[model samples]
Target: MGILSRASYVIRSKVNAVLNRSEDPTETLDYSYEQLRDELQDVKQGIADLTTQKKRLQIQKRRLEENVEKHNDQARQAVEQDRDDLARQALEKKKQKMSQIEELEGQISQLQRQQDQLVEQKDELQRQIEQFRTKKETMKARHEAAKASARVNEAMTGAGDEMEDVSRAIERAEERTEDMEARAQAMDELRENGALENQLDDRSSLEKELDAVQQDGEVDAELDTLKSEMGKEEEPTANGGDEAAETELEQELEDDTVSDVEVDDSEVEAELDELKDEE
Candidate 1:
């Protein structure tokens, strides 16, 4: 095809596609039904007009026939009275009326035929309108049902943008979780690689020595308090039997008392090891 022709064809196809998409099947059916009804109305109107003309012609023909009968009676009365000229005039007038009646009859016949044709056309149009209406209604219902199905399908399918947003959100959540996990692992590595040494690095040898001395003083004070409490519990009573009962109670209370002191021999050895390591 020529370029211009091809371009025109493309434009026409596009326009038709757009129109097809925009047009609703239900609305188109309704419009077609309305058009058929309008046509039916027009046919009925034509029948009415033809019937009116036929009635008018029938009335005219009837009047003309009455005048012809009146002329015939006048001719009979004139022959009896021997008035030939008047009778001839009456007959001539009667002939003219009969001619007019004949013309009117013809006109009435034509009108009747036209009325009959229009009536038949009106009936056919009515039948067609009814049939078309039924079809249109069916089409409309189907179109509505199809449209509802299409809407449901569209919702089920989901919009690309919403799906994309969900995907992006999931990706972001995964990325955030990975970042948190990496941070946690890194912290674990820092701890495993002796992060405590880094904190100790912030102190000078003099501060370490002072801290050990302070810790020793606190240990000594705690030990003195424990010893004083033990001495009070172990105080010799004036009675030997009371002293034996106190010794038995002291053995039972040792576990409880030591739990509060928190300064076991292992802890003391660990403190000594820390001091040596620092040196």
Candidate 2:
């Protein structure tokens, strides 16, 4: 993906992850109350509608009964006026009205039954909504208390341990200080014995001496010539220059070149031997 798209995706993913981890019992309670309220409203509306339907059926039945009475009066008037045909027609109209009234009564009875059922349903739904409200409140309280307890536990277990960390840091600092003091005392003893600095200086002096000796290789060769000449029965050719070089090399080798350092194991042993002889 492009950088912008990837960035957007990561941001959205993190936001969703955080939201998913968070819990909102109050919101859930509110949502449940809203849903129950809606259902309760529907139930009430249904009861009202059924009641209205029952009333309309009653009005229609009343109107049909009034029409039948009016038809009976007309039939009686036609018989009194010596008009049998007119009376029969009025009587027939009255019969038709009676049939219609019967049909309307049946519809009214059915509508009354429906209205009763709606009333019962509305009452039950109201009770359910009330129960739901009580449960939602309980759950909200429990969730709040649980969250408070978790915060308290975190403070006690996590933040409280900082005091212990400070104490441990002080202990470590004291240990380091004691170690440094011991090391300083040891270094002071080494300085009093003139061993610490002299040990480093002597090594450098020895290396310089070895370098000079290697450079005067001809002097060493002449020393071998002198020894060989002195051992032979006859005298060998000797030069003044060679004699001077050998003499200078020997004098330089004999000079005290080592630094004033503590002696080695063999020197200490030789000193102890001399002390024993003196005793």
lDDT of residue 27 for candidate 2: 94
Residue-wise C-alpha lDDT for candidate 2, range 35-78, written one tens digit per residue: 98998898788878878887887888888789899999999999
Candidate 1: tens digits of C-alpha lDDT, residues 15-123:
9999998998888888888888888888888888888888888888888899999999998889889999989988999999999998898888888888888888888
Q: Give all TM-scores, in the order shown.
A: 0.58, 0.50
The clash numbers for all candidates, in the given order, read 0, 0
- On the 0 to 100 scale, the lDDT of residue 124 in model 2 is 89
Against the unseen true structure, what C-alpha lDDT does each candidate score? Answer: 0.85, 0.84
TM-score of 2: 0.50
Q: Give the Cα error of residue 252 in candidate 2, in Å.
A: 52
Instruction: Look at candidate 2 and give me any clashing residue pairs.
Output: none
RMSD of 1: 11.7
